[model samples]
Target chain A: MKPAPFQYLAPRSIEETVELLREHGEDAKVLAGGQSLVPMLNFRLARPAVLIDVNSVTGLDGIEVEDGTLSVGATTRQRTLERRLSAGGSGAQDGGWALLGEAAGHIGHLHIRTRGTVGGSLAHADPAAELPAAVSALGATLVARSRDGEREIAPHEFFQGFFTTALRPDELLTRVRVPSWPEGTRSCLLEVSRRRGDFAQVAVAAVVAMADGRVVRAGVALAGVGASTVEAPDVAAGLVGEVPRPQLIAELADDLCARLDPPSDTHGSAGYRRALAGHLLQRALLDATSPTGAAAAA
Target chain B: MDVQQESVVDPAAAGPAAGVQEVTIRVTVNGAVHERPVPVRTSLVDFLREDLGLTGSHVGCEHGVCGACTVLLDAEPVRGCLLFAVQADGHEVTTVEALATGDELHPLQQAFWEHHGLQCGFCTPGILLTAYDLLRERHGVSEAEIREALSGNLCRCTGYQGIVRSIQAADESWER
Candidate 1:
């Protein structure tokens, strides 16, 4: 089936883009990579009157690491970030970018990754999406721009619900800022999908900051268990200053599994997703606490 | 400010009365540049097949799940059905028709035929183009790597054993 008819506009700059948005307001949809929007269009799930293609917008496709904050432009493709992360000197063993690289790898296939943008995925806010969960775990901030001005939104406040975000119709996500990991931080991402490139049935992204082989701080976030990516701050607090072992991890997993309630869909049952989320979190914790070559060098 | 815009299709002819809009896009498909007016809703696959008369790229799942409609946009493989023709304005597109030179089959095509890589042939074009991109980018790819790369392109026929062998054979023969 074809998409519903709409007018197409390609703006050359952010100022022009915001102007177009302001003019069209709720009637316009910003087309970033078009990986998510196009699908919705094809399915007729989204039928906007105007499609503001942001591909022509200048300076919206960059990745910069300044003062330990990784600023990714809204239009930066997943493949670009993945390539940067796995390249020499920033191998998968590296902490900060490696966690994201690992999560990016779990996203759809190479073709999807080639066109899927960081901002599009975040703004689409798919609960089963890996980028949002990883970004949430990393404590990233999303920057939104409109004709009025720009504002930074925390990850928690940014994601509203399933396929929903705090972004207004006349605003566009312009940048995502991911802060550097703590000095001795190690991170891991674990996802359980039906197939290799399918959306995660349950996934976990964890970051562990160790001091003398003990956990000084930790961050845990889950996907595919709720309306949006859920961050488990309480669990992270409980792991502080404690030695990360299989036993402790297993106990936490069991406890969370018993207490948590996950949404049920055709993919899996609520109980099954809760249990799987716990298992993935446990595995992520194990991987995060384990010493890698980069960690040993650090 | 005159933002860059092009509309090839006439709005009236393409269902303007029903609130449908049309856009004229200049696309270079298979080395031929054609300025055509198409409905704003026309996907790259539909535009190539319906407007440009290039049906080499078949549409399977229009929602971007199946790779049957995969094509190269600016040398990178992307889901054609997931991209509108207007999105291809000022861009180069390569469909399966460009894989071979006249009567001479591409090395990947020869390998597929030699290894019995297809049965129904419905999924062959997409698999071929995707494998073409993979071989062009990476050298000496292992069988496991080939399988991983082909995971996105689903082939219900031949059980993918022959398909894997075909890509491995092409990699060996083409790399030499």
Candidate 2:
């Protein structure tokens, strides 16, 4: 199938890429890995007047952890992050759920992982996607650059709503910085999709921090629940300060389900999604609090 | 601030330059460089199959979903449907044709034959290229990683078990 006609410009360097974006203004879109954008073009979903192909942009993809934060380039391939986590490279503390890294490894198999970059995934802003939730749960920071200047936005503030971000028309995401995994942070990522590679119908990411063998801090986020991932704040509130107990976790999940806005589609109904959200949230919390994850959290 | 910021999917990103010029794109395919005046809109898969007469890279989905058009870009396997021929300028491309040196089939090709890896053969080229890159680059890849890497390419008839096994066996033997 032929893509709709459009202009193509391959900028040799990042400076040139920024200049190209500056020249094209609102009609331009920056092309990185193209795993997401090209398909959208083929389907005729997005038709831009100019495409600044930055595949050749050197020094755009890499990951570095300094101090207490892990800074990952927007073009960093998902597999690369997965590999890093496999080697126990979780930022300063390594207290959060390492399950997120495993989930990163499972995204769309290996070929997609090779090309489906982490930045593109977040920029695509699919609510059912994994990285967004992973980053958001970690309270990450997104850095966007334009010819005008650069701006850093928190994950909660960066994501406006479904398929929507705070990114400007001329802005391009550069990197995402995730704070160190909090001490006593037990985290888990869970999804119930029709197929493994397919997008999940309902997914949940949670972190439960325990102090002195008691739950002291908890952060839970749900994807495919609404336009963007919703942190289960009130629900997690119920779990915090409680002793390690499965029934209380289940109760917290049920309370959290009431706050989600799941949309019905071919995959499952809104009601089903809510149910899955609660059940999966409970399961994820269990997995995160289990002995296997207990060590990581500690 | 004194320039135009064209968006993605624009005529500039999706079309020829303002002059509509046919630039000669040189690609080293299977260790041979072929230079031809290719339109700015041509896809790498088309350039390989239609222009260079290398049909090993099949286009199943025309999107990146199907691994039918998988090819090695500078020894790194990537989806050809998602790349433009111009992007491959001066890069080394290895298609299914590169598998046979002279008259001998590569070991991966032989493994497929021995293990019945291909039922329809539509996805054989992609599987071969992906396996080749994996075996060549990552000699010690685990079976789980091998399965995940090949997940992008689909096989309708072999149920993928045979294909995965074939790739595993090939990687062990080649040790590249």
Candidate 3:
């Protein structure tokens, strides 16, 4: 399949990019890594009159950490972030940041990650995508910029529905700000995909902070089970002030399954997704609570 | 749109286009620079095959799922089908055409041949390029790592056994 005829505009700076976005508005689509958008364009699912290519824009690809917050520029490639975290360099050794790396690894394969951008994945808002779930579980802030100005959106507010977001047509996602986890915190992201790089049938992102062998705080988010990344505050709330054990995790997972309302598709039924989410949440909780968890090792 | 930019493809040469959007892209493929005028909607694989005549990168499943059109953009493996020709502007692309010097095949190609990594040869170019990137970037790569890296590139004939063996064999003697 070939993409439809569209005008291409390559803006070299954020100012120029936003100006073009404001000018084109609904008629234009921002081209980030093109991992997702180009495919849609090829399928003719999205036929914008103008495409504002932002790859040439400088200062929109940085990943920096400051004031206990990790700021990842919108266009930062997934592979770049994965490498930084895997190498345990660039302040990526933080527990919360490592969870992102683990999740990024599950986003397609090396080839896709090489070109896929963090912001592109988040802004695309694929329900089964790992980054959105990870960020939601981490309580990350998404920054959006328009000709008017910039505003920050929480994950719950950012992801409106499948393949949709709270982003205005003229606003560009500039950066994602993830707050650092408290000390002694551990996290994990686990998913069940048909293949190694396929979209997850069900995925879980869990963060647990323990002190004196008791859960101080916990965050749980499930993907591939709702209209958007579903944050299970009840499950997280259930674990707080309790000793994290196999029985406790199993009980919480059962509760999570009852609370979920997943879509049934050819790949999996709603019941299957609900059950898988429960299973994954249990494993994720176990991994996050253990000192040698998957995320910690990652 | 800056009109002052170097215009490799003259719009006037298009003979009064009827709403066709075109952009001039200067891309280096296989160490050779080619400046051409391509439609904005032209995928990089189409530009490589139709424009530059580098058909080594085949197009299968024009979407990102099938990696038959994989290539090295700026030394990183990516789906050429997922990128527009204009996106390749100012970027260096390495196609399967650059794998051999004269008659000597690259080590990866040699290994693939030894391991019978291909039965149809349609997916060879993408696999070789993908394996080339994998070998060049990581040393002492495990079989698991190679499999994970090659997951995007699908080969139905070989069942990936020979492909995995080929990459493993190449990794053993792979330098740099």
Between prediction 1 and prediction 3, which has the larger DockQ? 1
* Ranking of predictions according to DockQ: 1, 3, 2
The candidate scoring highest on TM-score is: 3
Per-residue lDDT of model 1, residues A182-218, tens digit only: 7788777888899989999999988888888898878
- For A1-298, candidate 3 gives per-residue lDDT tens digits of 3877676778888888888888788898899999889888888998887788888888899789889899999999999888886426465667767878878888998889999999999999999999999998888999999989999999999999988999999899999999888788888888998898999899999988889989897788888999998998888899999998889889989987998899999889999998888878888898889877753234
TM-score of 3: 0.94
Q: What stretches of model 1 exceed 4 Å from their correct place?
A: A87-94, A293-298, B5-20
- Candidate 1 displacement at residue A9 in angstroms: 1.3
Q: How many Å off is the CA of B38 in candidate 3?
A: 1.2
Model 1, span B74-105: residue lDDT tens: 99889898888888999999999998899999
Clashing pairs for predicted structure model 1, backbone only: B7-B24, B8-B23, B8-B24, B8-B37, B9-B37
TM-score of each: 0.93, 0.88, 0.94
**Reproduced native contacts, each prediction:** 0.56, 0.34, 0.58
| Model 3 residue B168 distance off true place after TM-score fit, in angstroms | 1.8
| lDDT, ranked from best to worst | 3, 1, 2
Predicted structure 1, TM vs. truth: 0.93
